[model samples]
Target chain A: MAAGNEEISLPASARRLLPPFAAAPFGPLLTLSLRSLARRRPGLFERLGEHSTARFLIDPTDLSFAFSVVPDGASAVVRVTGKSGSAPSDVVIRGPLLTLLGVLDGTLDGDAMFFHRAIAVTGKTEAVVALRNAIEDAELRPSDLLGLRGVLARLADAGILGGLSAARHFAADAPVAKAGQA
Target chain B: MSGRMELVCPAGTPATLRAAVLAGADAVYCGFRDETNARNFPGLNFSPQEMAEGIRFAHGNGSKALVAINTFARAENTDLWRKAADTAAVCGADAVIAADIAVLDHMANNHPRTRLHLSVQAAAATPEAISFYAQAFGVRRVVLPRVLSVQEIAVLNRAIDVETEAFVFGGLCVMMEGRCHLSSYATGKSPNLNGVCSPPEAVSYVEDAEGTTARLAGFTIDRFGAGEPAGYPTLCKGRFTAGDKTGYLFEDPVSLNAGSMIVALKSAGVTALKIEGRQRGKGYVTEVVRAFRRAVDAAESGGDPVEIDGILAGLSEGGRQTTGAYRKTWR
Candidate 1:
């Protein structure tokens, strides 16, 4: 297992090619929102059950970075990195950002995506299965998962989501943005 | 001909139920979101509220809904299964497909008007077993296990008075449906007990440059090469090495495509043709039910049902399909 604490130093040339989202505050905001959502619904963690400790790598193929999550139900941690880069994970789910969001929001059927081979899944299937079930069982949309409320929730569903729908247009070396309560 | 054989479809969720109904299924089978049914997978099955909605939807569309309370009841929680049957009856489901005697007894005694259809899990292929269930529980229909031949089914249907249902499509279980313990041995989950085989929590799939490998409980089920289609990793379909050759020891990763035999099955006195996969989604339900509806409708006039075979080829497991024991090609 690769250590999360292991230092990753990128050369100036390598750094130039990285996605700008990797340098933004979106990662920390995602982590905080996840923790807040866990507080809102501990059942999400309860659903993960035996796979609570497992690390999941959610790779949105349209985005250059991936989110690594350990939804421990309490103090859950979600981290976004430019690349997984061999950091060991219990499971890895790779698919289009829209599809991933659709699954997260309970709009897409995970089994159907799997059958159509729209998503590439690997590693500890138990955890992946549990995670997918947890998400769908909660029926949470991006607003819910992000703990976005009221007008912000509306923005999440429309403005932010609409912007993300065009995430492909974002610079390959984009920087992070946003922060939230954990 | 006894007219068009009923096209019984699987409805794993509320969405799938509507899809099946709109696609021309004569009937759709589903279960509560509990161990009372054989397809007790996570995020699958319906709530009582959902079940009511599904039943109403099916009814409005001229499709019947069959609730499956098929799993063998655990002694401690027998009432849970009974409650499911009662709920199904209250929801006015067309029938309850059940296997457990206690569940059957409860439905028979408590909800006398609720029709009973013996689930395949009961493995009641013999004349005596089928008759006993019918006599004791007033079982009106029986979903036959997948192991029997068409000839064997034709013979058995003659000895029985009730309607017979056969699995004409979807994933094949090599073992007697109710008797499989392979998943229990490996992952402590059994279809009859927990209503799962090679449960999602115990299965793994690793894809890499070498293609993909599926495993259950740390045991490798099968390894697929690049460009090869993958199937769900059930133990019965796993590849194993015997004395010399290494291959699928029990059965290959092939789907049971009995479309061509819709006429033969009707001739065998089969009342329904079941398309298994309650754990599947709306896309699968719509596509499969449509193809089968065409086949069953065509078979009404003794027309060939093979023309629609092309539509089903891509939907099969591992992109491979077989007639199973229907043709008895192995014999």
Candidate 2:
């Protein structure tokens, strides 16, 4: 269990190559994105939240960041919690970067990653399962974690963001993007 | 594809129902919003209002709408099943596709005029079981489980009086349709009971230096190597070490594409051809329904069935396909 508070200084060379806007507030961005998703598919989180007040600690092992996700009514609240050897969470998930990306893109089977030990989870199993179901029901993507589709699309049009533009095209052909409240 | 063979399609939502109907589905089947049907994933299925509207739309287009109340009723929660049936009848559904004997009995007694079609979840493969359902519940049709071959189906059809429906495409269940308890053993949820298999909640994926792994309830079901596509980690499709060799012990990650067997199934006296995957989206429903419509029509017209092999390949599980037990020489 890597401590969240462990000081991780990026290499100077890596820092120089990083995107200038990479330091943006992911916590607020993710919260706003979740709100947007909840708006599109109302009752998605509500059904998943059913009587459970779960706090999830998501650790992307390949990254230097971790976050806590708490479902609040129809939307989820995201916080960049400290790794200060804090109290155990209701659910904890640790997985590689590619694994997380694959799950988000619907290209990787989450269960398969767990089977191969590429992903790991602990604590209240039911709560974790519920959250996973809620997310899978959403058929989410990495871009969905940021509520900047219009900006990204514009950037894509100007050849500034190739990946986001490709995603724009993908969304056009994407299946009806919702699971029912039923 | 015989002139009399009905093409039964799946609908996960109201839009899909319309897509299926407009694509020439003779009949479309769907479930109530909850666990009353097998494809009970979140964000899928029709509400009572949606069900009524979808049925009305299908009926307006001269297509029949069947309501699936197919999951087994818990000992303490039979009312849910009963309510689903009553609602279906009120919605004027052409039939109620059911698996539970209690549900069948309730539908027969409470909504006598509402036709009952036995769900594949019943796993009623033999004439005796089919006859029992027909006699006990007046079930007019049975969606035969996926374990039977074309020859076996023809034989069973001859011995049974009820109309038989067989799967022609989509997800393939390795075990006897309703009898398998693999998911329950691994995840504490069964398709027969909860109407979910490899439930999304119980499923998780992890990645490490080795590769990606699929897990169910903490048990590793399968692992994918670098750049390899990962399939859903249902217990039956998982790779396991059997003896000294490791492989898909029960079945592979391929989906059932019985497109090539439309003529054989029709010749076997199958009253209907079922295309699975109600958990899918409208794009899937639209493409599959339209393609199968062409295939069924061609078969009925005594011409070559449409060449839709690659058309559905992208939509298949793990991007591969099989005929399943339809031509089971492996057995």
Candidate 3:
């Protein structure tokens, strides 16, 4: 598990009832997904490699983890980096996991997110642009990961989905309940 | 009253351009891949080939494609703007939307036949500025800034010889289009130059046991409580600590949705209703353009405006909508 991962408010029910499981590192997960994608779309990786002239470091702010992504031949490689506070990179993207998922899913507007400051980029702007363009062109998603659904199903069987709903309800009601009490 | 007002929509990619055209957008505006246009975001806009293809697709669908080379050109990089204008003209763009004086001059001198429209980034709110652009660069229309009211727009239209476009929907820029520099103050890049505001790379959202706080360049812009929906940390829309209160000082985190005022806006002499959000996707372009098309047709035929209300709520920012400065109460 990523360091400081416990601090992030996962859906409320999950926090109360679910026990933490050992999650895999983000790098291996990303790499496996990218390799599968490259195999499916050979030209896409080449185009991405051409555009990704600089390296990128993605930081999930809620977790104590970061990743370095660089183009290698026709495919890109992702490696687990330690943290944002120490690692130096050409471009750095820091945001919440939900926002990252939203971007990958194409449901969230990256520009609007930037405008809102939910996602941030620092270092060379060109590198971030290249990465963004490549990602959008490739249209990768968290669901695109191999066997992700199976993993999710196992988690759901553990009452993860119910926990999420309970957390959401708790979050939605806490403020109103406090006001009512006051 | 005899003619229907043009419904101009935004197109970030060729797919969205095609979607807008099919959805009944009379004209679609897009920018080049670089910082030449205001909506310079990652994975958005078009390349030269994509622009040509987009133009072809739009024209085939009986719609026009307007290329936006709207950003201000640096003295050293004047050729980049010139090349973009040249490309737009060659690509058969119906119009080239520009804000810079130099870029306009280049378009006027070289591609005299290609129509020119003054960008809202110019912040040309008065007849004098509009007339100046019209006379100097043969500008056919002006995309008026967000500052003017419907009544003021009607008055200005009577004075200016050129056509006027007003924003009817999408994201709201609380500051004047071209003048705001809050992003530059925090990030090193300005919208006028880099074509980004509160750029993504400079933003970070910190979540803890208490809540989530949105930060821009290390400065905390807004803090969200446990259940509150955290919005983007745009400088203008940020909550700040005042003497005794802490709240949004400049603007709220809501989208502009003026579907209800289509008739009043048309009556105010607005020639066109421009929908912003060039950085949006085909789904957004299709939904917004289709709804606005129905709304415009309805308004022109003296029908109800509420027809589009329900369709737009899901797309609004933070699920909240406003008429913005168009309504006097918003002032």
Best by lDDT: 1
- lDDT value, residue B1 of candidate 3: 28
Best by DockQ: 1
How well is each residue in A117-148 modelled by candidate 1, as lDDT tens digits?
A: 55668887767776765664465666876677
- Per model, how many backbone clashes are there? 14, 26, 11
Lowest summed lDDT across 10 adjacent residues in model 2 chain B is found at B224-233
Instruction: Report, to 2 decimal places, the DockQ of model 3.
Output: 0.13
**Interface root mean square deviation for model 2, in Å?**
10.1
What is candidate 1's TM-score against the reference?
0.78
lDDT of 3 at A57: 78
Q: Model 2, A1-182: lDDT tens per residue?
A: 11111112222333333332452477787778777766766655653545236777877553445777777644578876543135356677875433454445444444444433455666555566555545544545444554446778455434523453344344334332111110
lDDT of 2 by residue, B31-145 (tens): 9978888877755677898899999999999999999999999988888888899999999999999999999999999999999999999999999999999999999999988
Cα deviation in Å at residue A21, candidate 3? Answer: 10
What are the lDDT scores of the predictions, listed in order?
0.77, 0.74, 0.73
The residue ranges of model 2 lying beyond 4 angstroms of the native Cα positions read A1-182
Which portions of model 1 miss their true places by more than 4 Å? Answer: A1-55, A60-63, A68-80, A85-90, A95-118, A130-182, B207-209, B301-306
Candidate 3, position B107, lDDT: 96
| Candidate 1 structure quality by residue, lDDT tens digits, B222-307 | 88775466678888888877789889878888889998888888889898899988876565667789888888887886666547
